[model samples]
Target chain A: MSTNVWNGEHRRIHMQEVGTRDGLQAECAFVDTQDKIALVNALSDSGVAKIEVTAFVSPQAIPALRDAEIVMREIERKPGVVYTALVPNVRGAERAIDARADELNLVMSASESHNLANLRMTQAQSFGALKQVASLARASKLPVDISLSCAFGCPMEGDVSEATVLHWSQRLIEEAGARGITLCDTTGMAYPSQVARLTAMFIEHWPHTELTLHFHNTRGMGLANVLAAIDAGANRFDASLGGIGGCPYAPGASGNVCSEEIVHALECMGYDTGVDLAALIAASKRLPALIGHETPSQIVKAGRRLDLHPLPADFAAIRERALQRDAASAEPRG
Target chain B: MSTNVWNGEHRRIHMQEVGTRDGLQAECAFVDTQDKIALVNALSDSGVAKIEVTAFVSPQAIPALRDAEIVMREIERKPGVVYTALVPNVRGAERAIDARADELNLVMSASESHNLANLRMTQAQSFGALKQVASLARASKLPVDISLSCAFGCPMEGDVSEATVLHWSQRLIEEAGARGITLCDTTGMAYPSQVARLTAMFIEHWPHTELTLHFHNTRGMGLANVLAAIDAGANRFDASLGGIGGCPYAPGASGNVCSEEIVHALECMGYDTGVDLAALIAASKRLPALIGHETPSQIVKAGRRLDLHPLPADFAAIRERALQRDAASAEPRG
Candidate 1:
């Protein structure tokens, strides 16, 4: 058991900013192409490890992200920051490759019910399509990220077995030759125990696979899950700026965990996320106007813990004030 | 080392509703007496272990809770629920006893700067006053809860040492006979490791005392702090409805953890809080109208995790819709 989660050798925690893709996809209003470029540029400058820039899906299906190609091409990519894109199939992968995306992300659900509801595909069909996309990705010398949606638990199917996730993971690794696998709590049904159990099993089973955990704060346990996963030694995780992403099925739930909150919590607990929270929050200042509403950001409302509030000039003379008030009240004059 | 925080031990968690006192005290507008009565009555019916009905401070100092007596007398006190009140001095204790409060709560700051700013008295003076109040409470046969504010950290004077907290805790126990000691993160500067370390020391040093934790989400770790405290074997906590409270010193900070969110998170993790979340949330629904503002409630926004959304009528036929749409788009438009 990894008893001390933060006290081991220097473990570099990586945060993937997914606001540009996962966050804006759920918005009713379309974020302009120039705004998308600006947002991604700001995130890149915030020293995030990776940024899921956009999704290369059918424009007809998700019109909000129709500018994926332009967003992928127009952004000024930094040297160390890896810009990734979500691709649904070979066609999207083709677009992503053409657009010079650094990484390609593919997703399929572990539960058949969710597979049908979310992607309009069966488990077998999704695997076949992803296999083809994986072949294309391999031929293009691009890395693949397979995000098994509902890896924690499914909304339609209450609990997804670990064996199912492992089986798909094995297929994605061997058959699709994938490099990374993301266990997504698509509907926020994950608890710390469940997260710890799965993370330990994944680490023991697939030692070479780069595992990432995607969480939604639908149940408000997102940061706790992060703590649990880190305790189990899984390094990479997905977070959205301002906590803007949400599971469409779980209406009214928080989108993803707030990037600033997660980074702040980890840094406080002595883990180095290497992301500057002040710069990230300064960038978050533009979100309300762009999104036309307040983002689910707690740090924006409550400044950093060390950011001191202004005290009255007479704070040191408080006893004198009290004594004077008491003396005045004791006098006989009204 | 408690490796498994959630073991087979049948641990019962207790939540104290402080919205009426801690939450409303910060409100710019006064909540009506009838509404206060209705709110406490609703909280009582929801089966919370304790509800801080009001603070018996000077009306001139805090006019928001000036109708403390009326609220206390009017609320339909549920059986098995402890209704507590905050009393700062001998006069406040007398008023609390007159109001028939079950418990009297007194507070002093561990940091002298905070002590001066908040109470207009030195630490020694505050201790003397609280000792007198404690004697009064002992005569009236009422329990006393002494919350050491900034037990974690203070804004003006950063990094409050654990020695300061332990020193005050010992004084409150030996000198004032405090039955309950709350280690308060008065400015939201307490981290999880600090919380765990202090809680363990307190538990080991004072086995007879009931230790409760009070957290502010000023830095977005309020719920995370709850998890840490629970891991350290603490079961009692203070939370407010709708996340209504804020630190007057820490502007734009969240006052208390949202009651429904904490209850919901605990119940999800299989801990029995014994409070009805739906019922508490139902009561929380009226807070917006009473507070004249939107609340920072996640459960209010997201609903319960088990609350399933309405599925599309053509959910099962999603594949067919996609295939048909694909086929139609393949053919050229007329």
Candidate 2:
């Protein structure tokens, strides 16, 4: 196997922040353009390898991300940090190119039902549209990546087969000339064995392509799936700040894997997730006020694992009392 | 090396429900004795291997569990399920023995500071008292298990070494003749690598003893740690319904790993957890009204992964329109 990732050997892990695009797109309330810009800038300062900055889809479809062009253009891009924007069609691709995005993320779903319900198109149509967008981006010399939603299991159609996922991935990579593919667990149905199996298969098939694993914590298996993917040799992951983001279609489902939570776990496991957890957590703490609700970030709520709490106010007295009791119990009479 | 738990090999996993003891112990409001007995009865029908029914500590110390004796007596003990009770000293052990508890779980912290702050005694005092409890339980032919709190890390002291944990476990297992041991991530400070290392060592040292893992979701690493422990050969886990229970001393920390969430994941991963998940979830859904607060259970909120959502209302019409649009586009439109 590919040098078991858990053999006490730490390696560099590339974390991509997707809260701005995937997370914001699902929110009902529109975040101000300036706040979005500020969030992106803060993430740029953190050491995430990439940021899915925004989506260039029709504003009518995702009013929450209507200020995508402005966000893409106004943010002060950091060197070495890839800024990607979601594009649903050639028009969105043109907009992303105009906004100077570093990469174009073409979107579609692996499951036909999800693709139809989500994109208002069939899987064939989605591939045809995304292929054109990929060609357009390629002509503009911008790297294009495909995000296959419901790759693991569809909320409407349970258990999308591994063969189906690979078939779609093959077409996306070979036919569309995509540089990377992210298998999105849209409703967090992925288990560890399934993740390991698919990750290993995908890596074996596309050894050189950038393969990212995107998971949702809807079922509380997000971090476990991440560990499984890492064990199977997939490094890149998409995480959201404050764990804010869920499938708008799946009510009661939790958001994306919490960015700070996953980073803390990876760092503790000896992986070098270049991002500064303190800076990221500081940014995450701002989400409750900014989003007008609480996000599901455990690390944000509990602080880092090592963030020590002060002993009880009467700790000295308690210790003194215990010591006295211990001494008394050890007395000759006793 | 231990057959790789994720090698697609299915096995039976033993799940222990600890909501009544560990979960309710930290709750401020008192769940009535009748309600406690009903909760335990519900879990008994859910196919869990064990239920930590109640704690036999002094009622003055934990008024939330003041009805422990009544709860223990009234819980209609299921034949196959082992009913366990937490005992802090000889008096508690005697009470548990009188209640006809199937197992006596003696608890103490691995860290000196946490032991003093939490149990109001030094580690030596806690151990001495627990040793007596174990011997008393042994004399009564009741199985004894020791839960080493802060086995992963302590909130006040931080990073309780594996060496410290193993040392205490050795003393409890060898000196006290304990039959089982639980390594508790009392503060949710465990990461996967740390769990893997410690579990392997613990299993290696005490191959014949039943090793149970108790984890908190304080940092969102609870389930991930569970996966790691399983990979390292641990089969028993302590989980709570509704994910209730946290370190009262560490405010803001999340509760124990959600029993339904973990069972759902394990069942999905092909492991026969022996849990009737639908029944377990039914019981978990009762937590909000019963406990008078919302729980942190993702499975209870999101439903099981295969609990499919119905297709959108206009899905047929949408698919028709997409198919018509695809035909038009393919016909070489001018």
Candidate 3:
């Protein structure tokens, strides 16, 4: 209800396109490094302020992102685009920094069970790794953003309390000196009320820290959650082009919230997303063949709401003529 | 934020499953009448108060719905489940009445251009036909529910004003004696603000009439609009299982809002939809083969948020054994 919440003056939320890295990571076949670079370059051209290029994890751990260095090097660095990479530890942070990433993203799972299962580390160990990465990025003069995965709910731990998320967020801000913090509904177990409540709590507790929302469409509440976050004064969001990501741990967890769909929804509601819907759809259309399956974006399948394919004026005349001819032919007099 | 609004005490909104009618109509291939009957029977078994069985339009216009009669006859009607059908004209209404349909759904497009293009009739003519159909259904002691298509916006005419929608709604309720009216975003152009504004306007004007909000996911604001409508005191909604159905005239328009998605969103938010999501997903899975295309419903692809597929405890030992076997086989000298 607050018109000022989405005005043009407020620093526009920078949408970070993560389809190339997180999206392609879950594909059945390996997307070549060149294609991944091309996708990132295309996203850069779409006016997205930030693009997560790739993850700097062990090649043996994630074979899909083996060519992260090549992808980072080959991408066309647009004038104002901030290229970021996901880093697991100090070694991964060094790899991202060496690749000249404009920003480094460190993720620590909020759920202890998920942290242990995913990063093979306890909460304390993961926090130590994050601190080390943050220190290294700071030393290298690279901006650091920390994403707290499973902030809303964890697949392993049935329900994750909001207090845990807020506490970790505060720690990430104070201890690691994270420049920005993103709360991830990693398994997409977020309800709209929960999103609104949690986002409001985060904003209230840490009013100065830059906050972002990373929601998965795993349970179809991605856009709904985004709307809730918007209501809670959250603007920055992480989305994948064509909703193209899957959680390796959570089987059947499909894509991240489709970037194009989010942009379309926000722009239509009179919010300034700074992303072109038509160009975003055009970019999404190229992914199905490149990824060997259809992207789950609704905007890609159905064009914009006002998009019309008008029938030519003479089409009815032609049909009428054909009908008249058929009627004449069917007459008995011949 | 009024809990009493959706507390299911004074007023409760009912969902009429239109999968059998609208869902089947959109499919290119003819779903077997028996299969339709089975689906309707299954929906009847669910706690949904109403099930729209089939449309009684001309077989020449839509061959997909030719077996409406058989589908209506075969469905096992439950005690409180009201079986309904779409009646385009007096003839269709008569047919529906003869088929023992509990309610007759009469449709009239609010936009004259769409009405003419889709129904081959002027707006006046369509209303005249609707009046006759409503009268016939009333004479037969059958309930009549009116659906105003393009109530929010039209494909031909970009913006359909609230005045036009309200005028037609008033005409249908007062002149035609329609029991209930559904405002349809046929091309899916309505925003949340628009939905809230229109719903508040309608409820204020037509305090005694039953109001239902039917939306499409063409622009991906379907659920958001539903939430807005609920916030504005609208109770009833029309949704298709697996988000089936599209307007033939509205090019590139996507399917109806998925029933399971809506139900899941509402239920998780503590609103009672009176529909089982797991059962709804089970029903939706049978649709791809029947419709000859994969459905766009998210719940079918990724189950509910609380749905857990926990790994068997012994599976970890099996994975460890496999890892050891691979490591041993990789040894060169041994």
**Which predicted model would earn the best lDDT?**
2
CA error at residue A334 for candidate 2, angstroms: 9.9
Maximum-DockQ candidate: 2
- Better-scoring candidate (TM-score), 1 or 3: 1
lDDT of 2 by residue, A205-313 (tens): 9999999999999889898899889888899999999898986645666879989998999988888889999999988877777778888888877888899999999
The digit string of per-residue lDDT tens for model 3 on A1-334 reads 4453222233366788999888888887798778888788888888887899999999998899999999998899999888999998889989988999999999988987777666656677678778988999999999899999999888767688988998899899999999999999898888888888898889988888889899998767787788778877898899999888986544554569989988887776677777877777888888998889887777777677677656446546544554565577579984
Checking candidate 2 for backbone clashes, the offending pairs are none
Candidate 1 runs further than 4 Å off: A1-3, A6-10, A32-35, A247-253, A316-319, A322-334, B1-3, B6-9, B249-253, B319-334
Per-model TM-score versus the true fold: 0.91, 0.97, 0.88
Docking class of 3: acceptable
Q: Could you give candidate 1's per-residue lDDT for residues A1-334 as a string of tens digits?
A: 1446533235689999999899989888888899999999999888999999999999998899999999999999998998999999989999999999999999999988789788887787789899999889889999999999989887776788989988998898888888999999888877777787788888888889989999998777788788789888799989999989777765665779889888887877777787888889987878888878888787887766677766668874776876676678679995
- In candidate 1 the C-alpha lDDT for residue A106 amounts to 97
Angstrom error at residue B33, model 3: 3.2
Which of the CAPRI classes, incorrect, acceptable, medium or high, describes model 2?
Answer: medium
DockQ, candidate 2, vs. native dimer: 0.75
- The predicted structure with the larger TM-score, 2 or 3, is 2
- CA error at residue A286 for candidate 2, angstroms: 2.0
